[model samples]
Target: MIRILLFSGLFTVIITAVQLSLNYQKETEELQTISQQLAETNAPSLARALWELNATKANDIGIYLMRIGLFKSITIKNENGDTMVFLGEKDIEAHQTSIKLQFEYSGRTGTVGTFEYQIVTDIVKRKIKDDFIIILISQFIKTFFVSIFILFIIHKLVIRHLNEISNWLNNFKPESSFSPLALEADKGSSNEMVKLKSAISEMGQQVHKHSTGLEKVVAERTAELEKLAYTDSLTGVTNRGAFLQAANEELNRSRRLSYDVGVMMLDLDHFKAINDTYGHDAGDKVLKQVSQAMANCLRKEDTLGRIGGEEFAVITPGADKRGMHKLASRLQQAIAILNFSFLPDNKNITVSIGYTKVSNDEDFKAALKRADEHLYTAKASGRNTFITDKGFLPRIVS
Candidate 1:
């Protein structure tokens, strides 16, 4: 648009200049031809011709020159350089000498023989200057409106839509809700925008899908790590650290509520003999079977874990001395019934169990120490029986 306006303005100026120049050229040519024609006539003809330029005819020609937008001054001077009759005036004062009109005539260069004249004016120059001003003002107004309209259309249709697209792309994030924006109404009316919108929609979907997949992978890995931290690698039962942590929490709860907490410490019967008789693999199987049997017999709230080599602990909250004894007997029975093929010839294995009940005045480690002693007693008495302090509640004689 700007280019077109510039070219149009330049073309207007060039045409105006050409028209003015042609007008000047035509006037110059007319003056030259009139001078040559007068020169072609004889001196007698020249005199007769000069007689025709009388006062009435000169006045008529002056009016004609004014009407035709010609020169402002016309005068004739003889070969002696003396000014004769002026077209628009009678004569110049001696102090105000006029410019001579020197035209060839009668095979001589005398200017109308003391009566020749020429016409000159500043009128045509002023008219051309005025015409140029008018043309420039008119063309400028036209060009201004054309430029504004063209720029307005471009901004509304193209620049605004492109800016929207650029902003959407800049702020988009993979974790955010990335639904593609609805294309502008004007954009939707076009097929190119529709295609662009579809592509952006697909990209958003792919980003959402990839984000979901990444989240799932992270969650699964976290779960696996948690299991490894809490569970025994060989038997899939709670490890020593996990069991102690849980038992401490349960003990704290029982203390707060004035309830009893029971802990059982058990060990496999003749575990070293089994590992020596068969192999470490068979010993591992026996441990797994015993752990599984104890787990099956216990409630979900009860905790069981492998605390050491062939040694295990079980915790029962809200259980008294009698309840702890009964639970120990059940665990012993469960271990006796476990069908383990850990021996050299697929022989069975049993476990000895011992348990302690926490009293109001005793700490958890003290109770655990008592349970360890009881476990030793059970192991010494028989490989498959359980032991507990028979007088734990009856002998509270304080």
Candidate 2:
């Protein structure tokens, strides 16, 4: 706004300066015309005085011309180059004009002398200076008020609303909900500001919608990654890490409650030979089927996991020595009855089991180690059998 006012003031100054220059030229020309008229008006009387050799009359005429204030000086010279009259100061810079003083005698006219005058410039300069001051003051006042009015109108109609829009954009957030943008000044008006508000509102909605969809996609991907981390890919059962974590939790719960938790380890007898003969794909299929069978035989409180190649573990909460033996026997029977078309008729699936009851306040790793030792013992004694901390069970031939 200040800039607008300055430019308007400068423009007014330039225009006024131009007008003053023209007025100066016009006033100078009018002075010249007045000087010419004075010379012509006094020429005849001056000429009669010079022809009659009357110096007094010419001097009187010159003095009257000087008193008029238009001429800086007046001088009359006779035809023989004699100065008859001189009045006032001679100003070399002033505008000068000369007229021939002619006197008519009978049928002849003769040039008697020269009438000359210099127009005073001081008077012209004074008038122009007065005019310049008046014009400059009036123009400056008019421009100042006009510039202020324009600035006010622009601020009310445009700049204030633009400030609101700027603030809204600065505070916008895609994750949080926000009220729609509106301008109170332009409420129902269908001007450009209203259109801008509508466009920004629409863009904000799209950003929020996309942000929500992105969050959902990220959540689903995270869940999938968690499943992959905790679950065995081939058997669809808890993997070794998940199993150990769950067993540890169970052990802690049993310690608190003063109850027994059965730990069991099972290894498929001669499982690698099946992989060598039928290929890894058949072995994977067997592992999947056997783990599923074991899961089916367990109670709701049991957790089955594939801890190693052809090796599985189970956590059975609230199970005593008798319950441990019973679950081991069930797992053995479930595996022996399974048949695979890809296997030789003479080859039957069998599992050797080792079982133990967790002692009070025993760590899960120690119980798991004890169960693994028992599994090794059962495998050494004979295949297709269950061994407990006490001794091996009677063989159940399949």
Candidate 3:
């Protein structure tokens, strides 16, 4: 851009110089022709012809010839190496130079002279010079303003957009938050810069899409891993580890909010006997049926887990001692009503259940232990019955 502006300035100067030089030369030629005619004739004819030349024309011719000598620094001279007229600043002694002229007449020829003179009173030279100066100054001013305008446009529209793109690319980072680039397209230009911005926008979109896809893949893999870690292989419910973790979380929430929580420990009565008599396949079927029944009985927020061989644990949030009693009885009755082919002879089966409400000072592990103790008590009293914590105070109907 700078180079273009500079070249324009230089071009203007050269053109101005050429135009001024050409006008001066053309005017000077006409003046020389008139001067030669003057030199050809006698004095009376010369004087008459000179008088017939209008004042304006004479003044114009004199000024035109003078400016040629003035600008070129050359005086008009005759053949005899004498000055006919001189114009401009005269310092011709440096070169000791003169000009040549040929004089002609109707019947004879003559010689004229040349000499250096410092004075320049010719009006045409001054006017031409003044006009040339005005033109040159005007062109220079125009060129300067044009250059400034072009530079300003380049900085504002081109340089500014490139700077913004560079900064965005440099600072780009991947995170949960998404960053977007939305630069405005050029209004009417179809230049290389516009194409480049379009390409960059395309690349940004592709990169963003790729990042989003990778994040989704990673999330899916994480979910798969969590499912494998927490689920039971045979029962399709939570494993012991997940059950404990879930119960602990629920217990903590209950404690913080002063809410009641209950735990139930259930075991299929004579489960080992059934497995031994009817094979493990029948035992597995019975386990699946019991798990489905528990799932049907539990709410969405309630948790159930397979803790051991034919034994299950349940966590009920916001359930007090009375609620625990009712839930345990229901679970026992549901199991009693279940008829499984565990013996291969198609005999009915039942489950013993024990439940306990979480106390304010007790943790999940302690509460679960108490529920286990109650489970053993129920098994000792009878194989297919349920027992709650009779020691719990003020049992209300759940």
Most accurate candidate by lDDT: 2
Name every residue pair that clashes in candidate 2: none
Pairs that collide, model 3 = 82-113, 82-114, 83-113, 83-114, 83-115, 84-113, 84-114
> Candidate 2: where are CA atoms >4 Å away?
47-56, 73-118, 121-125, 183-190, 222-398
Which tens-of-lDDT digit does each residue in 1-398 have in candidate 2? 77887888889889988998898889888888877887788888888999899999999988888888888888799997677788888988766677889999998999988987888888778888898889888998998998888777777677777777788788888778766677455444437776787788788778888987888899999988898999999999999999999998888888888877888999999989989988999999899999999999998889999898999999999987666777887888888889999977887899998888888867788989999998999999988887886643434445
lDDT of 1 by residue, 1-398 (tens): 66867887787778767877787667566654544344333233333334454445434443544354333344543445544435554334311223323345566754444433343424445666787788778767886787678777766666665667777778777778766756655642445655676678688779878997888898998988889999999889999889888988888888788888888889888889888987898888888888888899898889988989999999898887666766777787877767654343455667787787877777777888898898899899976877787766432223
TM-score of each: 0.59, 0.63, 0.49
What does the lDDT read for residue 12 in candidate 2? Answer: 86
Model 1: lowest-lDDT 10 consecutive positions: 91-100
RMSD of each: 8.7, 6.8, 11.1
Among these predictions, the greatest TM-score belongs to: 2
Worst 10 residues of 2 by lDDT: 389-398
Better of 2 and 3 by TM-score: 2
What's the count of clashing pairs in each model shown? Answer: 10, 0, 7
Q: Residue 93 of candidate 1: its Cα lDDT? A: 32
